[model samples]
Target chain A: MACHELIEGHLQALARSLPASVVEELRDGLIESYEDQLERLGDAEAAAHAAIADFGDADTVTAAFVRASPGRGIAVRLLLAGPVVGLSWAAALIAGHWWTWPISPPLRLAVGLVLGLAVLMLIVAVRERHHYRTVRLAALAGATGVAVLDTTLLATVVMLPAGPSVLLVPALAASVARVLLVVRAVPEMISDP
Target chain B: MRAEALKGHLDGLLLAALEDGPRHGYAVKEALRDATDGKLDLPTGTVYPALHRLEQAGLISGSWVVVAGRRRRTYELTEDGRRSLKGARDNWQEFAAVVSTALRGAPWPATS
Candidate 1:
């Protein structure tokens, strides 16, 4: 079969198991893949077929498409986990009855904001430094930052002397934002040609 | 061969196929083969992945149905898919014109 025919046939086979929208996207991606491979191999059809064979069968490729679909990232996980962690820490502060730090409420809020933003910046910087070239590293950094922020906020609340219940709300809110930042960063991290 | 050259146009062809109506995977393959007079031949395996990718991009939707005592997946285009197909069709026309002109011993406009 000609390369185009083979690709069309493969695409039709894929349509069986997926929605048309997804099949279309994969079709575009596959075309790009084939074009790139063809260029590398001097536009030889035989070379393209060999490359496809090496890449594995259609089912494997379909599963890969499913796996790479946007939702399954550490950033998304952190985003989802953020509100729960925030509420948990707020509950802990309320129920645990810990002393407030020597700092006043306004100072604590300022500190939290600065720390949160700094952590957000660090996460962004680490991610940008790699330019989505190291997804695992980016995911690890994002998850770690969120985890540390969560832990620190919980610890600070436990250490602080009694303060207005209102103070915990802002801290919780800041943590939630931090989590969102991490989640949003995930797409940038995983996006690659 | 021109068919090999047209490999990049598979998405457009798929959208065109779905334009007629929804069809299952095997049927789509058979139709394309018939349309091309057997010029385009494909392994039985390549179509499924391409279909899934298209679905992911919101260009088409698909579902499974049992036909003739066997299960098969059916696919159809979405609004976005229709728009994309039109674009692909226009591009392919222009591209084919240029390539055919070049192949016929005519200088490209820029070169001429």
Candidate 2:
């Protein structure tokens, strides 16, 4: 069952754009279909041809699978929500007097890294439509990154030397909201297929 | 029939195909083709992605198994999927009836 010639070629074409699991499932199905065709036609080549025809061209088949993925939708949702959450935190920080805090260059660097990852995730999600795996990876990374950064922000607000002031409420609220959303979405972003 | 004609209904049609029992992707394609009398409009390859999408939606579930000494991934409708399929059927029936009325140059039946 693993060794298929004609159908393997088609799968190879699909593998260029699809995840391995998706390609693997297609391989199984196509081989089964080819065997079914062989049973009736009694000619290997003809059966292969018939099977391939029914599945259509590599381009169309790959496109269909790509379109079916949820990665892009999740990425776009994260992208849309990011700014709102960002603005909320900014408002809280500016109003709460961020200048008095003993923030280090290393902490600032870490924050910048997370923000960079977020931007990269958005770019990949918006620009790359051909390969779904890339988008899925970006979303997973984005969610995890946001969860880490947001959790840290919430912790700092609670344990700050300066009392957790009412002005910090919006930032804390936004971080909590994002953490909840990330908790809900991260499992979904896991590669089940 | 044209693929265009089958657009937007592929998910429901796929759900219907899996209604009877769990089926491998190839079997689903066969069932769809047979049910349509060999006139299934869309490409057979599409069944995989549609099945995957349904799985993501929690409508159907897929698992790997051996069949006749060959590996295959099979799909079965979940409880949510059964409800979805029923909803699909209801919608299709209503749409068909309404469109049929329009096509026949007759007015729709009065709503109760």
Candidate 3:
């Protein structure tokens, strides 16, 4: 491949793993850097070789890009998932006997904590947008909230002999689905950096 | 020189490369090579990540400009970058002095 293409390919592949904005910046930077290399080395093929050799491989640069970028935290996805999963359980509860649904103190507390954290996550994701560490932490908090809620629901279902079947079952199922999504996504968020 | 040898010091060197004025990605890499007298030649692609890291850390800043019909991302050191560079240089001096003394078979407290 030509110098530019080689670098472009490397970056394009990384774009698959990183945020588009980051790959775009790296792409522009590399293309310009390639032209500069041509001027310095005075040979297209040799310059291409030098550029590739110096930049390391796709994997190495991608790793660096992942570390430098704010990460592809599934915050956006998780945020979207939250409402849908919550509604699914709500639907189940309403269908089963919404009037009889009991809101225990712990459930109320869990809801308060999740709402607080979700708001904080939204704030960081918006205000301190470029602060990757803070953003990721906020995302983790969201995931943790989901986990705590899911575990509490599961424990309630397992422990309480007289729990309402209609509401608790659907809530537990929805919480389980959310927990699964969080479980699957948490590693990707934390592992990138 | 191997990039491995320049690890923690590379950011300082990169900031120093832009001490004179802002330069595009390649120019900074060129300046790095020139400043090191060609001993610290690194993979050209690796520089962008480092540049991004520096920019993200607010140590430097970058913007795009068209040059010769192509978009180029040029970088310049921020005030924080300059301050960090000064600190890095002082640290380097201390480390270099110790290493130089050791390499020359001088005692730890040898007088100049």
For B1-112, candidate 1 gives per-residue lDDT tens digits of 2436657887787778789999755456557777889876554345554665687677989876654343456889999999999999899899889889888997556763
- DockQ list for all candidates: 0.04, 0.67, 0.33
> In model 3 chain B, where is the ten-residue run with the lowest total lDDT?
B64-73
Comparing 1 and 2 by TM-score, which wins?
Answer: 2
lDDT winner, 2 or 3: 2
- What are the lDDT figures for the candidates, one per model? 0.60, 0.80, 0.69
Runs of candidate 3 with Cα error greater than 4 angstroms are A1-8, A33-50, A71-193, B107-112
- Model 2 misses residue A71 by how many Å? 4.0
Q: Which has the greatest lDDT?
A: 2
Q: What is the lDDT of residue B77 in candidate 1?
A: 97
Q: Report interface Cα RMSD per prediction.
A: 9.6, 1.4, 2.4
Q: For candidate 3, write residues A59-168 as lDDT tens digits.
A: 77766654554332355656666777677666755665544546577766776787677656744543443344555677677667767766765664466454455656
* Model 2 spans with C-alpha error above 4 angstroms: A1-4, A161-171, A187-192, B106-112
The number of the candidate with the highest TM-score is 2
User: What is candidate 2's lDDT per residue for B1-112, written digit by digit as tens?
Assistant: 8877887788899999999999988888889889989888456687787888888899999888876675678999999999999999999999999788789977667998
DockQ of 2: 0.67
The residue-by-residue lDDT of candidate 2 on A1-193, one tens digit each, is 4445888888898889887877878887788778888889988889999889988888877666656667665667777888988888887888778778888879978988998897687668666757767777877787778888898887777677765567677777778887898788777667657
DockQ, structure candidate 3: 0.33
- Measured with C-alpha atoms, the lDDT of residue A38 in candidate 2 is 88
TM-score of 1: 0.44
